[model samples]
Target: MAVPRVLILRAPGTNCDEETAFAFEAAGAVTERVHVNRLIENPKLAEDFQVLCLPGGFSYGDDIAAGRILASQLDRHLGDMVRQFCDQDRLVLGICNGFQVLMRLGVLTSGVRETQPATLTWNDHGRFEDRWVHLAVDKTKTPCVFLKGIDKMYLPIAHAEGKFVTADAEALKAFGDAGRLALRYTAADAGQASDEVLPFPSNPNGSEANVAGICDATGRLFGLMPHPERHIDPTHHPQWTRRAQQPQWGEGFAIFKNAVDYFGE
Candidate 1:
């Protein structure tokens, strides 16, 4: 068995690097926080790690749009390296802003030329959304490595442009047929959750199919709007004090463990 090494890639506005790194460390994997510029200076540096994580933040101050500037940098400079990383069966995890970057990197959605098949756009709310959300992962539909053994998760999401959309019927069918939709927003209780559609607060940015996260065609590349790193401890639960028996760890911690275990397997 091998210990997984995670590269928590960061940029000027990346605020969640420490927490994301800590989560991986807590999950028994070695981790590093590298700046995007440093990686751009040497794109081959990515080959040193087993996992690439684009942690959450207001990258480049979310100027122009969230994750756009960073995405452009990767697309123009290290796209091949990243594609090779995923193609090699290595893992890529994108939280919030990281998810935005993955969308533009074509890690989650691919196509010819500028004719992209899917994208994350402005939230239908027309403002920033910062709150916890209940997420449901259907293993039958998604082969996501980070979501193994996860049925329901309570994580926080903070982003304004996290809505996912695709106009092409073929593209939508492809995503469905391939089981690319890895996660979705659900009710506080999983049993009563709606399928494919939910209103604001429940659906957050109004992502079609209630999608809160998606995996690439291979399922090795996974990105989601929610912040799993924020909920590593039981205290993170909103109703922890009201529980009869408190769990030692938060629901989100399993995702980190799953990432590390992927390499262990």
Candidate 2:
């Protein structure tokens, strides 16, 4: 079978493209790091790949907002290509800043409107957070293919404006109802069972419902504030030396592998 192709969409300030692409390549997919401007010049270039990724970084320097400039560029020009890519059952993954761009572009919801139902905002603590975190995947709820066979993950979250807030209480519930609320922060030491508020290090950004990531209704499109690429290698973990032996691979690689497997099938 031919290896799946992944397009690692990049723009000014997008520094993680190389590592993110490396993860996908190691997972048996070929990757091309395409700049947003190139895509803007020829939107049809997106048709060449089965997966599209928006990796983490402060796009356009985050002068106005983290992903605002890049998001607008997509909304104005390549919107159709993006919509078509997801409509074809292809995949899209956004991490950290990429997640923020997806939210602003309204592509996460598969459409655009004057007002968004949810958004990524400033952390409750009003400071940047950079550390490892525990994540839980709601298998019953989310159709996010990237999380298949994964129950929990220890990944890093580095960002200042990573909080997720819904427009209203009902809206938040609807996400939960539709299984759109897929990834969440769990108590570091235990599985997700309690309804207790996960403060500080646990929740990181104090996102409502301890939300850490989410998928579209189809689950084919997903975005999260955590840096999965950073964890694709075992040594990337802070406690690698403490473990008895090196693990075969880091959990983050599973995400890209799933995407490759989906297309391979």
Candidate 3:
């Protein structure tokens, strides 16, 4: 099978594009870091890639709101192109700030009108929080392409406005019923994943339903708060040195590997 091509989109404060590109490359995919302006100049350039990734960072200094500026640009200048890209059986992954962008662009919450049913707002603590987190994938739901073969993950998260909340109880129920709520924060020792929201440092941001990530109805487009790119290697783990034994790669590596394998299949 031919190797997949990944386009890592970056903007003025996107500091993770290089690491994201490296992760994809390590996963056996060809990757290129493209500036947002470059893609706006030639929207057709997106057609050449099998996967589009939005890595974590404070784009435009997270002014007004995280990812708002870049999201507006994409929505106004390249919305059609991106929607078409999704319809073409391609994949889109957004991490951290990128997730914020996708949410603001309404790419994740499709069919919503002028008001989004859900949004990522400031943490309940009203401050930036950065730390490693435990996450569980919702395999019972429509499987997310990026999360295929993954049950749980230990990844790092860094953000101030990362709390996932819905407009109301009904909307939250709708998302759960649709199986779009693909990932959630869970306790490190949790046996079975439940909707029960864990407390601070466990749930991390007081997100409704403990949501750490979500996928589109089709499961091709995904956005999450954790930084998978930062944990592709085994040594990236904070406790690697104290481990009795270690895996060949970190749990987060599988996320990118799954994206590349999706195309190979």
Candidate 4:
């Protein structure tokens, strides 16, 4: 099979590039870390990549609100490229700060521009929270290339503004009804354990809707306030007490593997 080329977006104050790229490489896909400026200067660069990943980090120091500056630049420079990506059914995965960027870019909503990208906002709690949580997968309707027919999976989350809110409540409901609610926090051992929604220590962020991640109406794009790259190995978890019991393939690693394999196809 031909290797899938993944683009890892980089910007001022953005971190976690190496880890995200490493995760993708481990998942069996070719990866590249590129600055947003490069893509802005040449939108055609993205044409060569099957996946675009906005990895976690405080871009522009998270100044004037998380992901605000980066989102504005992207809207101004690469908005057209983004639209074309969506039209092609290419994948866009935003984690943590990247999630904030996607939300601000309006890739998570459903309305006049719903089928494409929508918006995401701050968590109701109003504080930067970091921890893992379980997530329930509503796979009936989600058509995201990264999460095709997989059920659930665990991905550690670290962020203060990881909550997801939409201007239109009815649309959100319709999204769920259509099986577009990609990921939701749930009690531990709730069958959807891979979602990181176990309980207590697992549900760290306290997000509204217990939302760990979400997809747009079309599901080609995805945004989640989690750090799948953080937990690629069993050692990444704090639960040393159960190290022996931990599985060989940690939860976070699986998500990347899934993405790589999906794009590789």
- The RMSD of every model to the true structure, in order and in angstroms, is 1.8, 1.7, 1.2, 3.4
Q: Which stretches of candidate 2 lie over 4 Å from their true place?
A: 110-115, 193-196
Per-residue CA lDDT of candidate 1, range 1-265, in tens? 6898999998999999999999999999999899888888988888889999999998999998889999998889888878887789799999999999998877788632257888899999889999998888867878888999888888998999999888676676677667787788987766322355787788888888788888977778899999999999999888889999988789899999998998878
Candidate 4, lDDT over the whole model: 0.73
RMSD (CA, Å), candidate 4 to true, equals 3.4
What does candidate 4 score on TM?
A: 0.86
Q: Evaluated with lDDT, which candidate comes out highest?
A: 3
Q: Write the per-residue lDDT of candidate 4 for residues 19-131, one digit (tens) a residue.
A: 99999998888899999989988989988988889999999999988899999999999998777766685778888899888878876654434344334555455666666
Clashing pairs in 3: none
lDDT of 3: 0.90
Give the per-residue lDDT of model 3 (tens digit) for 1-265: 7799999998999999999998999999999999989999999998889998999999999999999999999989999888886788899999999999999988898854347899999999999999999988878884689989788999999999999999988888888887888988989898345687889999889999899998888889999999999998999999999999999998889999999999878
Q: What TM-score would every model get versus the actual structure?
A: 0.95, 0.96, 0.97, 0.86
List the lowest-lDDT window of 10 residues for candidate 3. 107-116
Instruction: Write one digit per residue (lDDT tens) for candidate 2, span 50-146.
Output: 8889999999998798899998989899989888877897899999999999999777754323468899999999999999999888877778889
Could you tell which candidate, 1 or 2, scores higher by TM-score? 2
